[model samples]
Target: MYGWIWRHLPGNAWLRALISLVLTLAVVYVLFQYVFPWAEPLLPFNDVTVNDQ
Candidate 1:
């Protein structure tokens, strides 16, 4: 999959590396800004319990 993307990206190695970095940052931004917020409530990460006897 990654090899395919690298092949499709325009220009030589330097330009492809820059493009890859930008693409990665964009994906991270989207996940943090939208996807994670939307999905957070459905996940059980915050569901904590404590028991005392």
Candidate 2:
């Protein structure tokens, strides 16, 4: 998969590196801004816990 992306990206080494960095940051930004928030409630990572009564 990574090889596929690396191949699909245009340009030589320097430009490819820059574009790859930008694409990575954009993916992270989208996940944090949209996907993570939407899935937050469904995740079990909150600080709260309940003891069986």
Whole-model lDDT per candidate: 0.99, 0.94
Decoy 2 TM-score against native? 0.80
lDDT of 1 by residue, 1-53 (tens): 99999999999999999999999999999999999999999999899998997
Clashing pairs for model 1 are none
Report the C-alpha displacement of residue 34, candidate 1, in angstroms: 0.3
- Return the TM-score for each candidate structure: 0.94, 0.80
For candidate 2, which ten residues in a row score worst on lDDT? Answer: 41-50
lDDT of 2 by residue, 1-53 (tens): 98999998999989999999999999999999999999999988886888999
RMSD of each: 0.6, 2.6
- Indicate which candidate wins on lDDT: 1
For candidate 2, give the lDDT. Answer: 0.94
